[model samples]
Target: MAVTIEILIIILLIILNGLFSMAEFALVSARRIRLQQMLDRGEKGADIALSLSEDPNTFLSTIQIGITLVGILAGAFGGAAIAKELEGTFTVIPEIAPYAGIISLFVVVLIITYFTLVFGEIIPKRIGLVYPEQIAVKAAGSIVIISRIFGPINKMASLTTDAVLWLFNSHAPQDPVVTEEDITSLLEEGTQAGVFNEAEQELVQSAFKFGDREVTTLMAPRPDVVFLDLEDSFEENKEKILTSGHTRYPVCRGGLDSVIGVVSVRDLWSQMTAGEKPDLTLLIQEALVIPEHITALRLLELFRTATTPLAVIMDEYGSVAGIITLHDLLEAIVGDLSTVDEPDEEPGIIEREDGSWFIDGMLPAEELRLLLELEILPGENEGVYRTAAGFVMSELGKIPIPGDHFVLNGIRFEVADMDKRRIDKIIVSKIRHRGDENPDEKTDNHTTS
Candidate 1:
């Protein structure tokens, strides 16, 4: 009986050793570099340890098989020895000896269970978690021998597990690398960890945010552009082009209503060498056109591959409404400033001290709402337009006119400038309070020109 108990304890210890080794493997695998670094510092034998640890499935199978075999060996030999001792001690009565043998076997089994469960499973797993690298190094030398002994059993177990997985329609190993959302999440984490400043973080976030942004948001609306009507004479067209100070102009067949193509000054210069009267028909090149709803990102790509700088944005009915350029897309990502010496014009709110707001129309609806300190502009149309003028124009049913004024949350906006065909510069001012009249408002002619 005593001999049986001793054997059971040895089996339990062997099982415990395997469990500890398994835990070490898991920890090293989970954090390979950390483990390797620790090993380099001479905590223990890291290279040999990590070899088994790196392959979790193999390590786990080997550990379980090794422990079980050891436990079975100890139990079988020890049980027989215990049974013999019990029979000798009880002597004489056959029934007494048999009963004593059974009791001894039960006790030995109970002891083995307690020792193996506590020391083998719980203790080592905990220690591995705390000092994984150290434990992994310690167990390095034994991992290979243990693996070899259990290789056949491990294969059988693996086959069974694979069969079960197949029955449930589980996927086989290889999964594709990185998703868009995953990349975004990683950026977000980097932001939180202070790896990115606010502007840099915003730039990354904007890349994802504006990838789906439509062409209309970045386009120069029709109202703000200077163009030559198809019927206009060559001299008249030349005058308009020179005065507009633009490198390119959109030429319509009849008027603004019949946009035919975009014509560049370079094209015009090339045509001048032909010595004809500079025919307007020959000046136009085919317009690279897209629906207004097409995303700016996609539009930018089309522009890149086509090698065209300008793309005409069209409405649902295929009428030219606006244009977007490569510069516009780039500015959307990094912002625009011609020189570093330029000062930031307005900080918090768009004040009425000056005639125009040097503000980005593409500023978020929430931000615009907060800056103006008004709730009149509902946050429903976020990311729809890039600027306040565009938002107002969209709200006003698209054909916003010059000298038109509207009140949003009691703030009055008068059209100050239109870039191309769209609202570009707007003068926003608060309405007069009941008791106090604004001095500037009264002097400046509240009547918008």
Candidate 2:
């Protein structure tokens, strides 16, 4: 019966103001990494605080209503108390008491507004943001109570917000993509926090670069590829198997060009115990095939989908260019192939006592680039070439003879070794002086056939 309209209005304002603060806290609560960290450390309320933040509208509405109610109560109590204190001093005319009441009311309201804005809204919001995960988890228990108290109001706010967004033709993405850069950043952070070593970080970064690499970059060149001749006697195949040190070999009748199927060591051993000549046809498993032009990333996907372990890489003419295995692809992503024998193509940077570089002839262009940190290797052309020798022959536009030391760019190349068709070994050294003229700069100075 004693309740005044002023008291009611103050109560409503306090509740609304509180609701505004709560909304802000809820919206940003979950994103607070600090709060999440606290929650992870077994903080009782921290987890709840983060959960409340996940649906900010509900938490915010509830808090806003509660704070608004409290703010109004503070204003009302102050105004009434002040009016009572001033009653005799300012009430010479009874009508003057109403104006005094109005002044007291405005002063109390302003004070309450200042404190509420500074402490209740701004301070809490700032602290919550600074320690979101921790704050959310700690506030989780309280947020639940607030949610229950203002359930209807929370629902209304959420519905209204959703409707407004829908009207604007805006919607949140489902299953947002985690970008390569995001993963890299996370890995970098992990590295800084000692979760990963330098080598591991480099490997991860290289794995991401797999998309730009082709199958040939990691393939065992055709010369180094081990295969079982279909025409060879069972004993001969067994001898090849024992000496070759391979778990799997292509079953080729003529050469790599006629590779029909892949023969596994398991199948070979199984037949050897049976006391019968192992039939090449019966022993071979279907070969997983791919083209040389296929990107290593796509090849990895193909390996996953097919559930096959090996793929024979061929050129456009259908000739087998090289062999790639699941182990090769894994090595591309992780490290060295564990089971596959290192191809006979050992391109070592032999630091001889004479101070001359004795680089292996069978060295791959990629290996050369990696070791020398040079960018001389050409990209994939429509030809079946993978090694430095293949690259040199490609550049020369003819078969490279044994006694040739061609200088290109600032790097000098001496033919150390050569086979019938390709250059197997080459020795390269960085020249101190600019060669006669810049190869790229001279209009007609580019090396010709």
Candidate 3:
């Protein structure tokens, strides 16, 4: 009967140990943001859970104390009680009688340790991890009460830990956590595991890179920007405006540097249809001016605050650098926006039968990098230049004329055509290494203007 009572007490201690283990794991793993969301939704015990999580050290100290005490008591009472009961059974074997007490004690210790480790620790921890929020909320109130009861001991333990850490010069520093990289890594792993499809992975990766992009990297270059001279009459520029296929055009005073404002095609069309001479200055709305070095994320904010669809990018010297529209910024986040009009000319990138690529110089270096799968470009100076032409110019230290060629990192870059001053077309081919007999080469045929 005494042995039965002892066993029951050990079983109770094991259960208590499991509870403390569960509470500790659950509290540590529970997301505070998720708890606050639950609290906002009027979920029960979420507030308590959040409060406990905020001062985790105190509540965790309480759990540690409970677990330690239960373990000690279980080992002390259980080992002695079980060994005493087993001594009678060992006495029947006369040869082993001399070592029976020690043998019984060892057996009892092993049984207690195994049950405590499996049922009390491992299983409970797994359960806590699986249902952290639920277990944490349920355990929060009890742990808070227990912590208050053992406040003095918990305080002493915390102080001791702090003192020891200070003595060892091991103060924990709160570093800025970057969760985007972690999420990106997880998404890549998920793709490999077939949990995420190719399109889903690309969208997620694009979202992560969106905040890091600069306006210069995404903006249409100055040469590509179609604008109207304020000095030109409505009749003179009507053909250009109609053929441009753009909704808005920057109305410049003399050149791109002397720009005044933007003219919407809708306003011009209305005036033209009404048989009224459109006053260019009166029809123009003020253009939003953003620095070229500004990030795409910041550019979006400025666009929202200014309530303008298009912004003129300015260099450090106050000259017109490029132009960016709201559509361009959205494309940076969600990928390219398709246009309705089909152009008569061919696109900038063309793939040949020999597996070589014909690329346009105006394509952004980032876009080219994605196309070619190059780890790093030879002369790619980020923020200094945006396009593949700029990268080649930086490397060659001059404008590359047609037929100018160079080799970098086992890839051959040949200027196929030059548009007067700027590089127009480049032929890119891989210089195969000695032993690579048949490399599986694939090229992205897509082009960026």
Candidate 4:
């Protein structure tokens, strides 16, 4: 072949190699969520891109085949055909004439390799990775056509791969899925990029975890529940309602276990404001009963269908476990919402002046982890326990009594108070060590309690 034709063919091969490199990297880097979004908008070739990305064997085999062929042809043909032409040019210098063939072959290989690496691999793959979804959509049609052409060969390659894996009693791993960590990292990255504020990023992260969290973690456990008794006179129940300052009261005849209905303070106050007698019985409405094990997200949906936001969470034993509200679910998503019912003095977590903490027994483990700066809490994955009290019970393997304490992750949890068998108040302090560690967080549960 002529030197000009040989050079042109090598250039064409490099361009083909670049195309294959771009397609392979773009498909690999393209996120399924972004591709699905593009498809939802009815963008042309998006569906094909999504399909090609989802089937790695087809598109991958096709790209590998194209790249392999391009490399072979470029190396083999450029050396035999173009190296002779280069030798003729090198022979012009008589001093190097005898060594022209050797010099020409080395020069040809070096130039081709350099161009192939830069234009064919690095640059194209960088472009692909930087704008993966967009490039995937744009190249989707061409890639699909190539995949179709190589379908039989692709199938054979897949079978060979599977057979090798079968020898090891293993199969190829499935493609990656979007995980909580992936979304969390994205949210944090957005925060760093100024796309979302820190609070907004936290809200999104919490919302993502909403479905995975059970009601038990977020509920006001039975110990903290303030109820009205039907056996008590209206004046007695009124005192309880005014003292607790809660919006709704579970109206129980016997106890929390025998909750008959819920009564709203608004109803009683509305009648009183209208200069009419407040009748507690007339204001009572049946509370929605839900299993304690149900997710907070599912309960959020359930609230949408109910007449009132209040619900009684029943344990597997059919006894009332706790009470929850739509407000509770919203607070879980958006952080604490202070209401007329919630007294400012009684926050769930309180940092003492001594740097120790006064955390309520009902506080969720997730929130505790954030407050304590701990990596994880025990039994979080298994749903074995949800609250700080539950954590204490699990660690101790019994109902903890007042003054009982334990240390974990350098934090000492002391059972400061107990309401019957249930934990009511916890004194959380750092276990300080006399060392180079930060003075505040180190040595005997540092609070001189």
Best by lDDT: 4
Clashing pairs in model 4, backbone N/Cα/C closer than 3 A? 432-442, 432-443, 433-443
- TM-score of each predicted structure versus truth: 0.48, 0.53, 0.78, 0.82
Candidate 1 TM-score, C-alpha based: 0.48
Model 4 per-residue lDDT tens digits across residues 194-288: 99999999888889878888888877778778999888888998889878888888999868899888988888889899998767788889789
Ranking of all predicted structures according to TM-score, beginning with the best and ending with the worst: 4, 3, 2, 1
What is candidate 2's lDDT per residue for 184-219, written digit by digit as tens? 998999999999998899898988777778898778
- In candidate 1, clashing pairs total 15
- The positional error of residue 220 in candidate 1, measured at the CA in angstroms, is 0.6
Worst 10 residues of 3 by lDDT: 440-449
Each candidate's lDDT (Cα)?
0.65, 0.68, 0.81, 0.84
lDDT of 2: 0.68
The list of candidate 2 runs beyond 4 A from truth reads 1-195, 305-308, 337-385, 433-449
Tell me which of candidates 2 and 4 scores higher on TM-score. Answer: 4
Q: Single out the weakest 10-residue window by summed lDDT for candidate 2.
A: 440-449
Stretches of candidate 1 off by over 4 Å are 1-203, 273-276, 305-307, 337-387, 390-449
Name the TM-score of candidate 3.
0.78
lDDT accuracy of residue 54 in candidate 2: 55
**24-120 per-residue lDDT for model 3 (tens digits):** 9999999877888889999889999999887777887899999999978885786687788898888789999999998898888899889889989
